[model samples]
Target: MGPDDAFWEDGEWVSWDEIHQQIQYKEWRAKWPNADLSLVPVFEDLISVAEDYFLATGRHLQVYGDIGELYAAITYGIRLHKNFAQGSDGRLGNDHIEVKTIAPMNTKDQTSVKLSGHFNKLLVVNISEEFEISSRMIDRASLPKTSGNILKIRWDDLA
Candidate 1:
């Protein structure tokens, strides 16, 4: 697992919430100046697409980094337990939802770790633009049985 990746099963949730509440783009960019925002529009666009897909298909959608530790933390946030099953439209209707981030490892980088764990009913989604390294990677996994309307996003449509 990468330093950024965390295992929620044994990690604290407050840290995740803390980062979520505190981290912003401006502040984030101050830390990593070379960061690119070209993908910002793409991120927004993909989010809307995922939202629409979820609404139309009632599927559970999540965004994550390619690192396993990061995604594990996300899955932990969703409270994934053993023997979890897929809900309607390939979603987990339980208190926690199943979403993940699967990024391809760089073949040139021999030290890269694999984040793709075997999920019998896992639903993974990727939302990143080519060659754009995002700094504010977040995992927004939902809790099980959280009754609410299907996602309805508002964003710019390149489509």
Candidate 2:
């Protein structure tokens, strides 16, 4: 299939309605049901931007990955650190947090999670094929030894 066809078939093209129905959105709402609705317009705008980029380039952007990280950071009240030699993605008080996203449907076998830098805590965000979101947090000290830069923990190990 052509890139455009593949992009569509792969479900990378997202709409505001689809995003709103996602598990991440539900989780956000459950936590902050009283949050102002004004934030939604910005989210809708971001969806449009992602869709436009895909249509013009026929390449799936990392918007969903970014969204996953942002969602996790906001939920945990963590601040995203700059990627300049930073070992972690966000900071929770004095601890470092590494956020990882997994879309099982997009992979044949997603085994070990990868780490870029040292972190005190690890957050695994799993997005299922149906857009259901689930997460887990583990301490770096409890994990197995690292092979090169990869953690020895497998996807099943986290379950």
lDDT of each: 0.35, 0.63
Best candidate, lDDT-wise?
A: 2
Which residue runs does candidate 1 get wrong by more than 4 Å? 1-34, 60-159
- List, residue by residue over 1-159, the lDDT tens digit for candidate 2: 434333343556555555555766676568756433334445446546666676687655666566556556655666777756468788788888888776534463243545667788988776654445667788888777765777544455776
Judged by lDDT against the true structure, how good is candidate 1?
A: 0.35
**Top of the candidates by TM-score:** 2
RMSD of each: 18.3, 12.9
Cα shift from native, residue 28, model 1 (Å): 10
- What's model 2's overall lDDT? 0.63
Positional deviation of residue 138's Cα in model 2 after best superposition, in angstroms? 0.3
TM-score of 2: 0.58
What tens-digit string does per-residue lDDT give for candidate 1 at 1-159?
434543344565345545553566556356435434333344446556655665687653544232322333333333334443443112233433334433322322112111232222333433333323222222233212224533221111101
